[model samples]
Target chain A: MRTMRLNMQNVCLTMVLSLIALGGCDRQATVSTTSVGAASGAPDAAPARKLRIGVSIPAADHGWTAGVNWWAKHASQLYPNVDWSIVSALNPEKQVADIEDLMVKGVDGLVILATESAPLTPVARKAHERGVFIVNVDRGFLEPVADIFIEGDNKAFGRKSAEFIVEKLGGKGSVAILEGIPCTVNTDRVEAAMAVFARHPEIKVLGRQPAMWNRQKALEVTENMLQQYPKIDCLWASDDDMALGAMQAVKEAGRDKEMFIFPGAGMKDVVKMVMDKDPLIPANITYPPSMIATGMHLCVSVLSGEREKIMQYMPRHLMIDVELITPENAKQYYFPDSIY
Target chain B: MRQASTRVLSLTAGGWAPAAALILVITLGFVFHGDRAYFNWNTHRDAMRQASVYGILACGMTAVILAGGIDLSVGSVLALVSVAFSMMSLHRQDSAAMTIPAALMIGAACGGVSGALIAFGRIQPFIVTLAMMVAARGLAKALCGGVKVSRYIQDADGRYIALPVPEAFSRIDARLLGGNIAVVTVIFLACVLVCHVALTRTTWGRRVYALGGNEEASRLSGVPTRMMKVSVYALSGACAAVAGICQAAQLQQGDPEDGAGYELSAIAMVVIGGTRLSGGRGGIGLTLIGVLIVGYIEKILSINNVPEYARLMFTGAIILAAVLLQRRWHPDSEGRG
Candidate 1:
């Protein structure tokens, strides 16, 4: 009886080793087959149902875009099951191609920051047609393709900046305008400022020029304008970096006494200047780069079955409030540690 | 009298002509806008100062062009060097002496890689540098983790801290002579001088010109063509790196995306400087002129209240005009081809 039991045990051990070897082979085959299947569009039987999210954004060619990229990456890390892919292109045509590529990759949802309105509307519409959830960030699209549109109220930004200048100059001072990139945000800001400036005809606009969101360009432009308008009371810049350049020019020209510069965008540097009550930079408008986080939140909500609460039938345009960053509230906007 | 008159005209034609033209335009601009205060010494100085960084990069680019090669990676190299320098400076706050050299070395190393690929790997300068541009930018962005790394001050206890420098350098920057001139401006001028000497006075310089003028002949003449090609790119890389470090120091931060689209500007400056894009000709002096022209036009436009879009259009037009002039001057050299 003992000899028979020893033989049986040896047979059992051999069977177990063969099973382990077969299992190893099975895993290798599975990996290669899955890769091949993905390439050939074979339907996966126990498909890993990943919640794929597409992030469409402008190229990180500037500070704001850099911030957007940072926030998007941060948001992606917070969700594990969701596969996040980022595609950044500077122009509308490239952006559209990126969107189409994402669609082919079979994403469940998308987060878009359009480079322009009309050029991106069709792209958003196409994504919506394919029943993909869409969340628009910053710049808006013309068509009602987005389930949620998140952006700052640029008009308010303009009005607030203008109001500060009018109040500071006692509603009667010569001011020059430094416009941002030509877009809806720029147009809205200009229109809003115009509305306020129209009320106070005494506040003469010495010269309005576009700084193109470049510091050196702003410096040169401001210097030239300063030369042209020697008696200027204040300078209104659409962005903080440009305002910084303008202030530098004024200081360099020894005309600090004749100029007060207020730039928008509430960049950390500008907020710091406001907090310190820098004479040349007394006030600025707040438009945070973190609105990208809101778009990501909406996108996640839709993918995670909170779709009804997040999605609206009409294009849901969200206008984030802009705070006029002066000495009083500058501390609130001052993030010394923030990258922006 | 006739000979003296021709000499005066040639002198003016070479340098003073463009300078005079720029001055005349500013004067005309001032006269046209009678009540406007656009033409002044300070404005001109500020414009030139702003253009100095681009000027330095273009000076290096002119050398590369003269050697019958192109470097699209200069801008990316600049961004990387700037980021590397800023990070090092912040990390090793106690070792201030090592910061500048270390930053320069990092730039040289990056440039050396591009040189190796072009010279030894038998890669086309355009393709190699293009890849370097994309890769360097990716590396820079990755180094910062795709965020703007702001200037931070270290505490006495050797901890990182935030300190805004908007006013920190104002007093220093304001001073003349003993005052802190923007290191960038000084470095730019120094680079121009050094490049001038290297191109005109050195044996290596002769080889660079010979190679650009005729690579096959240079090879046959035993000029060590491969080494020369590598050295030229490495030099361009080093210059870019210096520019990057200057940009970071001035901005008080290392921005991963700071030098975006700057390679084109650098190339434009070189091309406009009357450097034959086909290579083997042109000098740094012409690059300075090109830089001045670009800087002045931009300054003048902004001073006149031109919109941002218009400014871009204007810059494009000026670049086109400069290129046209270059082509007209060198009909046999199809630089674009």
Candidate 2:
């Protein structure tokens, strides 16, 4: 027993030293899935006269993208004269392949929301060079190749959320942050939020961890955060699904009434919390999945006969507003008919 | 005396290398980021909860690998089963009764086809499962009509707010044991128990190991090799189905996207457990250790709040280090899966 104990101690010392030198623990994960092609809307209709519009986006793997699908189909119905082909890609390779297929099928306009910026950029650029009217939504291409770019202001979403937390906490308190997946978009949101928190020296960030953009992951990560910090005043869950997960963890820890949570995205359930004025969730940030509809509508407007007037009036870069969902404006954002 | 001493020394140093590494890494974790959060009972309990899915999958994978075969279709089966469980149920959507059996069947059916192709049709296990992987995931997407199942959570008012999920279907993960231990952990333990017993005790267990060690020799010696191969793959499929069910329970919905790359994790666990991918060595108990190792590593880093990008690199490095150390103890085997 003594020998074993001695061995364990020696090993433990080496392990700790090695760990520190190595920088930290390793906890990474899965590759982005290869998306398959799925089509919505009818095939060619009056091919000669109608404007052919191809919509490409990521498959609805989570709550947010499901809303994208709902809006895409909804907008497809608005213009019967247009030939709409909405394709959802699962991975970068499949996305590139699907877009190539779309270009071959002869679309006059292509609206793409890339899965990853790097792979989709060149292919989208090729589509653009070929005179395709490119309308990029949510995720953008590497170059400014799109005729129009439309998205929720993620950085603003992050900044405004942190700003609200600062204002609510009177600019001083301990906060735990739950980040989504480690991506450029997620980084932009987090860094912007951190910048807001940085300006206020009084607000200390107790813990900030990636929740992998999933509800279950958020629950587990937040549980760890709760154990680490006993006196957390507020939690910036960043995303609604994450907020819901964190809220559950806090409640499971039986500190629901004590802790304040701010989860973004106008996910219906979280929106309902704002509508009901749930004590734990005082407010939320808006990053609606409905931006796809806005993109689709804009593409139609740009391609319509009034193109000269529309181009003069509408800007090439369009940032949809990020609203704070308090009890007052919660009703407008609540869409019962929408999937997400 | 010298031989015995070396046996003891090697057992301590090499046989338990993964365990030693696990403890060492965890201790380092506490040293770097330890506090109430890093060293608590709930943290350990949640660690087990997190490991549960891979624990379940790895247990069955140990058997499949011991039979000198690999099954890559586990992830696809997980996707299929989770989607089918949600889409197949005629009654209440989240009803455990309707969901569990249907998931298992779908998993088994996917496995059965792959097994048949590999065992009887004489295709490579890798090829068979690779095809099954894409086909199964495709079917899952088709079944869900390519939309995420919405799930829900309750508010302070005790009012139910639905999140459009067929994703809301998971309520199983919410069940707790004394408010600390997750029911998911219990499910994982039960699977480990059954797999461990069946792998170590039964005549079939011996056959599985023997076939993996030497299929031609085992077959000539009256072991039913072909039947065993099919059974192992089927068992793997069924195990994956259980994992899918648990994931749905935990996530509270059927995610067609769930378990997308989880098979690699399971295979990693089984391989780390000192199970020779070339077959003929290792057991389910070893896999449990691997699952715990990976689980604890994930938990430790998460609690420590390590920079997210660094997490993957550290995980890969340690997995490499531990496996390399384990390989030196067994000079001949590739020690890979």
TM-score of candidate 2 to 2 decimals: 0.51
lDDT scores of the candidates, listed in order: 0.71, 0.74
Look at candidate 1 and tell me the lDDT of residue B223.
93
Candidate 1, residue B89: how far the Cα is off, in Å: 1.6
Q: Please write out the lDDT profile of model 1 over residues B81-144, one tens digit for every residue.
A: 7777767765445243676677677777777788788889999999999999999999999998
iRMS values for every prediction: 32.4, 16.5
What is candidate 1's lDDT per residue for A170-284, written digit by digit as tens? Answer: 9898889998776568878998998998899899988789887778889999889988875989889778878878888999999998778888887888888889988888888
Compute the lDDT of residue A186 as modeled in candidate 1: 85
In model 2, which regions exceed 4 Å deviation? A1-21, A25-340, B1-14, B88-95, B152-171, B335-337
Q: Per-residue lDDT of A1-340 in model 2, one digit per residue for the tens?
A: 6565456545543654475445643321110011111122236442334577888888776778777878887888777667676777665544664575466556778888887664476568778898888899988665678989987888898899999999999999999999886555797799899999999999999989989778899999999998988899999899888888898899999998777999988899889988999999999888988888888888887887666677787788888879898999999989888877
